[model samples]
Target chain A: MKLYDYVRSSAAYRVRIALNLKGLVYESVPISLLEGTQLGEDYRALNPTGLVPSLAIDDQGSGEGILGQSLAIIEYLDECYPEPALMPATPLKRARTRALALQIACDIHPLNNLRVLKYLTGELELSEEQKTTWYHHWLKQGLSPLEQQLGGDDSRYCCGDTPTLADICLVPQLYNARRFKLDLTPYARLVAIDQACNQLTEFRQAHPDQQPSHPGENLTRR
Target chain B: MKLYDYVRSSAAYRVRIALNLKGLVYESVPISLLEGTQLGEDYRALNPTGLVPSLAIDDQGSGEGILGQSLAIIEYLDECYPEPALMPATPLKRARTRALALQIACDIHPLNNLRVLKYLTGELELSEEQKTTWYHHWLKQGLSPLEQQLGGDDSRYCCGDTPTLADICLVPQLYNARRFKLDLTPYARLVAIDQACNQLTEFRQAHPDQQPSHPGENLTRR
Candidate 1:
């Protein structure tokens, strides 16, 4: 299997974590989102949305078996590889876990996505402060509700003691949030869960800095 | 089961269609989104995000088994009642089906939702034209990729012949698109699918106009 990935894409980070968690080895085919490689015809053909983090399954010598949408791909991975389940066991618990994931994936992240920010600064011609405000607006909007959903539960991860889909979705968004410099003090549970996730090798391996696109460049940035 | 629904909510409409398709009789408890009822404290307890279309299952005598997020609710319904499967059979097909559904549910709908639109007009203080542009911008951005994903497949619905999750998502989005007066000519496949879906009683009954909140107003408006 090969993952069409971008270092900075949080969605891509999700699949990377899932792959590492399941102990599946896959070649990373970097699609430089910043350099506009995703807009090229070839990548567009593979993924109509031209979004990063498309997993291509080895289809028994039938060429690349491409799949899109991080959640869908992750779910597929969970279904295909059941040894370490990404989802919970029961229906009700699964719904709760998925709802937590979707709260960020759909409601929050999409609004503050890179393409959306670009549109605000490029097409709409909003000022830099305006763009920052827009970013923080959505970040707070999403995080506040997420904090509520997680509640005061004493679970090790987002949904349970074990890492599930909700945790997969949570870690990436928190990483994005810190990148934009939003205040995380309000979301104690989320911050704690994120800290716990960071200690894990799977999540650590999938961090943006570890990606081939920008190898250990956190030093260069600082 | 009782559904906390909003008549004009695209997300709520999706759940309504799913319930109808499964022939599950659910009591429609209309939560008026336009009236700001969703923001009230009581409703917020059920859904911290203050979003409509939450399904409450009567778990015997264990109070209301509330579930939020349309996709999660629909999946729960599909899992509990497997007579008419909402997702495809195989993992790959299921991924394809979910990818198509998420294409609309996450990407398109959230950006142009009532809350987001209201934010644009209220906080941003944008003119009506600017607001409309914001709406159409996301509509085109999402739908264009969707058209490509659907590819010239002659399926009656988005995934396959029967009305799967993709079709449930497609119908509401198409309805919203028409409301905003976007040109449907560009997405021939989606338009055709929407037309086919409308012919079904499940889809027809879930239409915004058919909701109790505003009944027969389609005729009164004329």
Candidate 2:
């Protein structure tokens, strides 16, 4: 198996955490979103959407094996490798877990993705201050409600005691929020959950700074 | 089951379609997005995110049955009602179907959702023309590759012969695209799939126009 990956993409980071939690080993092919490597003909042919973290499985040499969209890919992984399931056991809890993930994935992440940011600053010609405002506005809009949802819950993670898909999604989004310097104090529960998840080796291993292609890595190796 | 819904919301429309496809009956309580009904205390108490299409399910006296997020709600319904599966049989095929759906849900729909458009025009002070341009830009960026991905596929639906989650997502997005006057010619494959899905009673009954609170409905009755 091989994953077309980018170190800093929240979507890719979600997949990396899931893989690590499942104890799965796969080759990580770095796709440089910064350099527009995802837009090249070769990557587009591999993933028509031109997105990172496409999981390519051999599947015993039968049918389409490449998958895109982080949540979908993570679900696929969970279904195939049921041990340490990323979803809760019951359907209702599963739905809640998924809803939490989608709240971040659909509502928050897309608005702040690299391409959309480029559209704002490049095509729309918004100032950097305006762009930062756009970023914080979405973070607050999404995370404020999330903070309320998680306010009273005392689960070790987002959905349950173990790291489920919700936690997989939340950690990376918090990482992005901190990178943008959004005030994290408002999301105290989320911060506590992030701190708990980071204590796990799987989550720590999936951090952007730990990836091969992160800017902090050695230039020669990268 | 009760659905907190808005007639023109793509997310609510998706849940409506899923309910219809699963042959499940639901009470549609309209939350008018235009009138800021979703922002009211009543709606937020049910769904803290202030989003439409929150499914309130009485799960045999189980806890936490209210499900938010269209995909999560649909998946819960699919799991509970397995007669007509919204996902494909195999894990890989299910991944493909979900990837197709998420391509629209995360990438296209959120960018063009009501709040984002409001942000574009109200906060950023973009002209109507600029908003339209922004809408079309994302449509092309998202749908062009989707068209190519679906180009040679002969399935009656997006993932297979029967309508899956992919088709459920596609119909509403195309509805929004046409509303924005996007050139459907560039997305011939998606347009064709949309036409095919619309032929079914399930899809047709789920239309925004068919909702109780649709603007075309008599205001007094509403």
Candidate 3:
């Protein structure tokens, strides 16, 4: 498998975590979102959506192996490699887990993604301050309710003892939140869960900073 | 099962289509998005996210049956009542189907949802024309790629002969685009698929105008 990835994309970060949890090894083909490589014709040919973290599996029968969308890719991985399950056993529990993930994936992340941010500052011509306000607004709108939902739970992860899809999605979103310097004080429960997930080798390995294409590497080497 | 729904919410509309496809009888409990009813304390208690299309099931063991997020709720219904499955059988096909669905759910619909539009006009103080531009911009960005992806497909539905989750998500999003007066000329394949899906009794029943709470009713009566 070859993963067309961008280090800073939360969606790519999600697929990385899922792959690590499933103990799968894939060659990382870095598609730099910062350099606008994903929008180039070559990447668009591979994945028409021109998105990062598209997994290309080597299908013996046919050459068509590319898959896009982080949740879809993660769910595909979980379905194929079901030992360390990323979902709950029961239908209701799975629904709950997916709901938590979707809360971040659909409701929050889409509004704050790099493309959307660019649109705000570039197309809409919002000032930098206004952009930051937009970022913080969506984070609070999403994370506040999420914090409330996960508040009373004593589970180690978002859904249960094991790290499920909810945790996979939450950690990246929290990472993005911190990048924008959003205050994390209001979401203690979510913060704690993020911390717990970060302790795991799988989650730690999937951190954006750990990726080969991360921009922070040059400064660190210096 | 009881569905906490809003007439024109694309997310809610997706679940309504899924329910109708599965032939499941769900009482529609209208939570008006236009009236700020979804953000009220009562609705928030039912769904901490305060989003519409929350399904409340009568679980035999406990009263904890409220489920949020349209895709999660639809998946739950598909699981519990699997006679006519909403997902493709194989993992790869399912992933492809989900990728198509998420393209709209995450990429397009969230950008143009009622709340996000309100934020653009209310918080960002964009002129109504700017808000419309933002809406149309995202629709083009998302739908162009989707059209390219679905261009050569000969399937009756988004995935296959049967109406899958992809179709369920697509119809509502197209409905939203049409509502915004988006020119549908660029997406002939999608428009044809939408037309094909609308011919079904299930999809027809799930139309916003068919809902008891739809604002269009009074005008029709007059």
Candidate 4:
């Protein structure tokens, strides 16, 4: 297996954590979003959306194909290798877990994504202050509800005692939130989950700082 | 089953199509997003994110247990009633199906969502023209790539001959594109898939105009 990844991308970070949790060994092929390499013709052929974290599976000893979307990729990994399941066995539990994941992946992440921010600052000509405000506004809209969803549970992870899809989505979003300097004190359960996840080798190894594309500087901050 | 829905919500529309496809009888409890009904305290308790298209399952003779997120709801329905599968049988194909769905559900729709549009025009005070531009910009970013992904496939639907999660996503987006007056000539395959999907009774019944909240008016324009 091979993963086309970008260091700072939250979507790519999700796939990285899933891979680590499944104990799958794969080569990381960095596709730098900052360098405009993802927009290149060659990379676009592999992934039409020109996004990071496309997993190329080598099933049948011959390459099957590449898959995109972080949640889809994570679910694929879970289905293909089911030992330590990333989703619950029951239908309703699975739905709840996926709902939590989608709350972050769909509602939250896209609003403040890199391209959206670029458009705000570049095309919209938003000042740095306005851009920061935009980022914070969307981040809070997403995190407040997410904080509530994860609050009532007394589990070790976001959905349960073990890490599920919700936790996979949460760690990366929190990582991005910290980078944007969003106040983390209000989201107690999410913060606790982040702390718990980072304690594990799977989550620790997949940190953005540990990626090949990291610039030898710590991107994560308290 | 009872579905908390809004007529124009792409997320809700996806679940409606999934339910119709599965031949499940569900009562539509209209949650009028435009009327600010989703912001109510009671609805928020049922759905922490305060989003539409929450499927409340009435299993075990109990009145309800709410399930949120369209993909999660569809997956739950697929799991509980598996005759007409919304996802593919194999992992790789399922991954492909989900990737297409997420590309729209996560990347495309959210950026141009009703709430996002309101935020743009209300909070940011963007002009109507600027808001339209923002909507078109994100829509194009998503659809152009999706067209490329679907172009090579000769499948009747987005993933294959059978209607899958991708088809469910495509129909609503195309419906939305028409509403926004986006030039649809470019995405022939997608347009064709939308046409094919609408021909089925399942997709026909799930049309936004057929929903209870639709004010007996055609929202889509050529």
lDDT of 3 by residue, A1-222 (tens): 888987778999999999999999988888877788999999999888877879998654556689999999999889888989999998989999999999999999999988999899998888999999999998999999999999987999999999999999999999989888999999999999999999999999998778855555323221
Q: Per-prediction fnat values?
A: 0.82, 0.93, 0.92, 0.92
DockQ of each: 0.78, 0.90, 0.86, 0.87
TM-score of chain A of 3: 0.95
Task: Judge the docking of candidate 1 as incorrect, acceptable, medium or high.
Answer: medium
Model 2 off-target regions past 4 Å?
A60-64, A213-222, B213-222
Q: What is the DockQ of candidate 1?
A: 0.78
Q: Model 4 over residues B51-137: C-alpha lDDT tens digits?
A: 898888975543468899999998989898997988898888898899999999989999999898888888778899998899999
lDDT tens readout by residue for model 3, B1-222 = 888988788899999999999998989888877788999999999898878889999755655689999999888888988979999988898999999999999999989988998898898888989988888999998999989988867989888899999999999999889888899999999999999999999999999888865555323221
Ranking of all predicted structures according to DockQ, beginning with the best and ending with the worst: 2, 4, 3, 1
List runs of model 1 lying over 4 Å from the truth: A60-63, A213-222, B60-63, B213-222
Worst 10 residues of 2 chain B by lDDT: B213-222
lDDT of 1 by residue, A35-136 (tens): 778889999988878787789996544445799899999998998899688899888889888998888889988898878888888877888898889889
CA-RMSD of model 1: 2.3
RMSD of 3: 2.3
Against the correct fold, how does model 1 do in TM-score?
A: 0.95
